[model samples]
Target chain A: AQRVTQPEKLLSVFKGAPVELKCNYSYSGSPELFWYVQYSRQRLQLLLRHISRESIKGFTADLNKGETSFHLKKPFAQEEDSAMYYCALAFTGGGNKLTFGTGTQLKVEL
Target chain B: SAVISQKPSRDICQRGTSLTIQCQVDSQVTMMFWYRQQPGQSLTLIATANQGSEATYESGFVIDKFPISRPNLTFSTLTVSNMSPEDSSIYLCSVEDQTGGDEQFFGPGTRLTVL
Candidate 1:
């Protein structure tokens, strides 16, 4: 069974501080990881994928096969960055199915 | 990116009743999925809505309890039958990006509260 774990239920940081949302996965095969964000009153949207290796909104995540972790990171947190972040994993031959982790509520204080 | 919409954005229903949530996508998509988000929990995939065929349900999800229909590529519906208070959750529909990048675009979910 493929499982994604996000340890933090809530992460609070002041503006301009660095932010890191931890995520780990348990999958046997090669896994593709992604980060999704949902702002207040907005629908869920894709933030970035590991395969792309591109940063979105100053957020970046690297897939660590050795540690089985794909943590989201941002250098300077902005007040507008407050939202719910979800880490998801998909494996080969899974038919595009995604296993999501319990989201982390990021509250960036002014 | 696809524009997705869900009907009956929020509904309060009595126990034993059923509520059908409709999902519509602006463009045709090959794979559509239904998900449930319980209060304070992560989103769980319910099933994959296959066009012109029966939906493929995930483990622990049964067709009898959550019936899904995908008559076409752009539309799908999920019905929660014999609802209970435990069924209170936000049901969302999403479409896989046609470019095949494994990214999914989600619709504004339908919030159901059963009392």
Candidate 2:
């Protein structure tokens, strides 16, 4: 079974500070990791994917195969960056059903 | 990436009643999924909706409580029957578009609250 684990429930940081949201996964097959963000009163949207290797809104996540981790990070946090972040894994050939981790609520204060 | 839409963005219903949520996609897709996200929690897979067949439900979920319908490639519906307070959650529909590296596209979830 493919599983995703996000260790933090809430992370508070100040503006211009660095932020890191930890995410670990357990999957036998090659994992396809992704990060999704949900802003207040807005629909959930894709933030970044391991395959894309591109950063969105100054946020980036590197998939460490050896560590089985895909942690989301940002160098400088902004107040508008406050939102719920979810780490999801898409298991190939498993009906493409995505397994999502318990989200981390990030609060970026000014 | 596929564009998805869901109806009844938010609703407050009494216990013992049922609610059917609708999901529509801009393009045709083969695999449509239904998920339940409790308040401040992760998303749980409820069932997989495929055209021309019955829905495949995940563990701890039954067809009787969450009946699903896939009328076509671009649309699906999930009905929560005999609802209870515990059923208060956000219901979301997603698509695993094979063309888009199977990246899942999510719909604007339906927020259901049971009294």
lDDT of 1: 0.94
Kindly list the per-residue Cα lDDT of model 1 for residues B53-104, writing each as its tens digit.
Answer: 8899888999999999999989999999999999999999999985857579
Per-candidate local distance difference test: 0.94, 0.93
lDDT of 2 at B17: 97
Off by over 4 Å in 1: A92-94
Candidate 2 ranges beyond 4 A from true positions: none
* Model 1: pairs clashing at backbone N, Cα or C within 3 Å: none
- Model 1 agreement with the true structure over A2-110: per-residue lDDT tens digits: 9999999999999999999999999988788999999999999999999999999999999999999999999999999999999998755436788899999999998
Best by DockQ: 1
